[model samples]
Target: MKAEGGTTCGNSTKNDSTEEVKNQYHYPLTLPNYTKAEGGTTWKDKEQVFDKAPKRIMANTRPAAELLLHLGLGDKIVGVGADFGAPDKTVEKEYSKLNILSDKYVGKEVVLGTNPDLVFGRGGLFDNSDGRVGTVDTLNEMGINTYVLESSVTGGTYTSIYKDIKNLGKIFNVQDKAENFIKELKGRQEFISTKLSSIKEEKTFAYLHITDPKELNVEPAHDETFFNDVFKMVKLDNVFKNETGEVSVETLINANPDVLIIPDWNTYDGSSANKMKEALYANPKLSSMKAIKNKQIYAVDFNYMFGYSYNAIDGMDILAKEMYPDLFK
Candidate 1:
């Protein structure tokens, strides 16, 4: 399938923090206050130094859950959660595809129901205001290990994916697993690089983060960011380089990106992509844009594109394949 664009929602703010839905739970708990770190706030690991792999694990996103499965720890995941926007079926299907037997527990109440020992999630997972899962520190205080994905909290490049795996390996007492996983991941990158090297005539693209039909945000192109770095590797010029937030239709029409990237988040309704495409098609200002003109609009999953994980390599691969079909064949 043709994939389009990159993503950069920018540094998250306290006001925009995710709100955890409170569900009924029967678990012992102690919550903690939020503390600010250097660049962002962090939950200090109250129960550091895990002697072995956590038998009961909880990961809140598809990519995180997939990463654990990649490390051959699917059995360790006792509970999983899907994005709030995901359907009930997708929640099960995503995990079952990984051969993991876990339930979708989105809010804190559902999470506590599973009684996980270690939780793997982005900072967004802990909506302290709702006091559902409480804060990350709260879980830690309760003797539950919490490791938030750095990419979500602190931003990172492609290399950070390896670090995530390596860190998990260290915590799980499976350094060898981490190393082997990285080796395979390196092989994936090498293969893509081989494909990328043979390519010429790379096209410029724009990833659109559209929260509403009328408003849009283009991923930061040519910035010192993971999204920029990946596009650089694939040799795609970003039409909206260094741009962010509320890209006007006139500006988007003027920039004229070769391709348009749409995410699963905004398109969660299943019909959203089509609605967006139709809207763009009907707009006199956007109809003539190169992306729309050439049918270069592509829909993609959020985790593989915006997320910082080994899974992101798939995003890179998808971009490369679309840019140079001959390289893939």
Candidate 2:
């Protein structure tokens, strides 16, 4: 079995995470309390499960679209959601690196215009309130199969990506592809763990989600299912380990973390991470923090880390290299 799509390599490692992955592979989805997103549904247990391959599918995010191609289900995909086939990018320019999907079909529209029988969202919350593709439940009720990537469930882990691929494979009747995909991902994780296993030092780290001039929504340790495994895998301390609840600028400054893992998403100055780095350096109050002073603040890619897709292996590798440059080199 061979994996279709994986990490966008940038001089990374190759190693065996098989044993470690087997030991810590399964991460349970206990569900989280959401303020804005959908709530009160037993998704892990009661959600709709697909029995056969869906035709005329809508891949809502780039990662979702990528997963379709990886599964060799590109032909089944009627609409490529999340701006992949937008007017600006031609099919050639959009998927130049993905040889498998080079000649496959792609849609320029985001929603209903394609009239899809199924919709795949990277996250759990997608209500009709947004007025784009309609809610998952609505689609499901209308006889259209819908699935929320397990990773998008708040409190999901790296295992969520594997679980999603596996579940999707079962749904699409392609179990072989899912198993191979997980194998490849574990290999990538092993690559990072083997290279940086010698380190015992634990640096206090925080994942700043939104970095506006006034405030930032930081993922505290209590609610960080994703980053906890990531930081632990690389042997780094999470700053918010002892605390929970919403994070503010004052809280971050007071904690004075050893490293700042800013997952930048906004599209400003090429990428928001660079923009965030600039903002932190210029801010008089934040400039004095330990992470800022030592220049240990790293602006990481959003989808690679927070995207909660198969790209998580790439996220893990990025963190390891950033945390231990000497070891990787």
lDDT of 2 by residue, 1-329 (tens): 22334434542232125423432433222222112224443444345644345677777666677776677677677665444221112223443333222222232234666677777765543555442456665666678767777677667788777878877776666677788878987898888878977866777887777657446667785754665765666776787865767777788888888888876554323445676788877779887788888888776666665556776565567767876799978
> Model 2 — TM-score against the truth?
0.73
The weakest ten consecutive residues by lDDT in model 1 span: 19-28
TM-scores for every predicted model: 0.70, 0.73
Model 2, position 291, has a per-residue lDDT of: 84
Task: Give lDDT tens digits, candidate 1, residues 1-329.
Answer: 11112223552332233211111121123222232332334444333445344678877766677778766677778766764332223234545644332333366766767788887865555655432344665676677777766555444577867777777776665577799989988998999888777566777778777655566666554433566555666776667666645566667767787888777554244556667766766666577787877777776666666555566777677767866788799
> Per-candidate RMSD vs. true structure?
13.3, 10.5
**Residues forming the 10-long window of minimal summed lDDT in candidate 2:** 27-36
